[model samples]
Target: MTNSSAKTRAPLSRPIIAGVVTALVGFTSSFAVVLTGLAAVGATPGQAASGLLALSLTMGIACIVLATRYRMPITVAWSTPGAALLAATGLVEGGWPAAVGAFLVVAALILLTALVPQIGALIASIPASIAQAMLAGVLLPLCLAPVTGLALNPWGVAPVAITWLIFARLAPRWAVPFAFVAATVVVIIGVVTSGKTVDPALLIPQLEWTAPTFTLGAVIGIALPLFVVTMASQNVPGIAIMRSYGYEVPWRPAMLVTGLGTAAGAAAGGHAINLAAISAALAAAPEADPDPRRRWVAGLSTGISYVLLGGCAAASAALVLLAPPAVIPAVAGIALFAAFGSSVQQAIDDPGERIPAVVTLLVAASGVAVLGISAAFWAIVAGLLVRGVLHLGRR
Candidate 1:
């Protein structure tokens, strides 16, 4: 690269760096969590890798098409956040089969929401505070994983996590990048050399695909939560990021895309495919290109990367096991802390419902699972119930 070209590109480097980092996180930390969720439900390694492959393909194609036509830096992602919701699906009575059925149900919800604005409105009608609370609550337990993960290699991850928290506190822009770098090095030195490696074969994908089975356990338990999670975690955040950047992508088709993609992923041994927010922000921002008209090219570029990876299932498996477990938790926790704080603050800002809102936030952060529903979802339900009862008694 010539000095002049390097200098020219430097101005746009921030957004590019952010975009690349976000995508990396989507694959490494976020992908690892998804695998963990899959295993919690007894999905074999083959199914987990298949799920990742399917999501990448679906997201890649959709993102390329939408962003190109729209002439924006739009991004599409498999529902990484939906891992929280997938917890119940993984533990259902029929396990993977039931989970697939549940995925279809969620897909139906996505289709319905896309076709019906009233449904979107109903989803939107949930107070921003509650949504924030729900988000924070869902993510709260996940944040704790890094801390415990650090215990696995305190000397390695402890320093990385500490450095990340400090950097996140002082330098918002550099936090993730710096922490990721530090963690990667530590994993190599601390975890990898310590002989924590799984058999390379155990981590590779099995190309053999299985057909999905419909089941009652999946419909009642897995499907319901998957729908809620995809909505709460993926769609909600995705729309917010788009709105934040002044894009007006229609929600209906987007929701349909998410639902359908998830169904495909389920059939391929994956769970919860939906839009992405954090990485999408990096792509949609002005830094993707100086002339917004050309931004589609960047989306096209990302899509190409996705396509290559999706076709190579073995690569996906290797990527999943590429990083140390501790690294995933630290990256995720540090990344979401600010958003989590904001949610907590928003949930309690209303003077009338301040006390109850606090209750909502606490319930969500508690990570308590009841009736197979996540704490985040239940927190919203519980808060709404409390808020409703209080409102009604006054009436």
Candidate 2:
């Protein structure tokens, strides 16, 4: 190999830095949502903490093994959108146990897809525009958190917003990280000035395990929808991201590993663990490494960061719980801004699919819930129906 190739292959490079930051972004960006979703489904604080730790550790391990084995940048993440769906689904009949049962079912479905090649092909066959539209819709509400937060707490949010904007202009890749750091600073200052005595003992995460209880309602209403959303919105997009960056890794094995990890997490409270969608770009992009082949180091770095975060999940949860509710969402919005923009652009770019895409986006953004199902699922159904009708009319 040439000297340049040797230099690019060096470990602990800038790509690894980016990977670490990306992992932090992935956790901080949507963890609040995960907590909220779990609580809505009847998880106690301890159970939620356990779930967070479980998902993070398993996802971290998956990312490490897959990257090393395949020599590809394969990042794993908890399904943020799936968590949101669970939150929106509200309280189920069997509560937390039912949610755990649903999680197992979803993992089984993912494992089945991995074992059956046709299922993977079927997911891959989904129209990119439709998928993007649904994702755009799903993310739209969360993206608006900054705006709503600013309205609620200008003093706390303005600094973070400004930090994001400044860094985005001066150092694009660091925008979200900078914003989160700035927000943490702001929160710390508030806590200090307010004289709120927080006992350090509260940081200890109590891991709670809930036995799974299966119900037909949860299996259909929660499991099926969670499986579909995670596959279509996260895993498929993750594959697209890798392809866009010229990385080809086998999908089946990755699915199997993530599926098992997700099932393990379910017993502890996590909803689903799947391929990284938004953060995958950070690890796989040319910005990570000039030489595409060496970027697997980025995935390795991300995995290490995730494991550290898992170790501190309880403390992180405590901090988030203490912060202003709007603050967490605002920080998350900052991290997701680029993703929302890209999804929106792709969703509306094709004229032939525009109407259907719009339908999906609107329904998803509306946050409608019916029969314990989230709008994200119905948005795709609505979009596909419109597309079918349009196609028949054209014929």
| Best TM-score among the predictions, by candidate number | 2
**Model 1 TM-score on a 0 to 1 scale:** 0.80
lDDT of 2 by residue, 105-195 (tens): 9999899999998877776676778877877776777778899999999998899899999989998867777787788788788788887
- Local distance difference test values of all predictions, in order: 0.64, 0.82
RMSD (CA, Å), candidate 1 to true, equals 4.7
**Residue-level error in angstroms, candidate 2, position 98:** 2.3
Q: Which runs in model 2 stand beyond 4 Å of their true positions? A: 1-19, 285-294, 393-395
Candidate 2's error at 318, in angstroms?
0.9
Question: Tens digit of lDDT per residue, candidate 1, span 139-192?
Answer: 677667667877775775776677776877897656666676676676566445
lDDT of 1: 0.64
Worst 10 residues of 1 by lDDT: 10-19
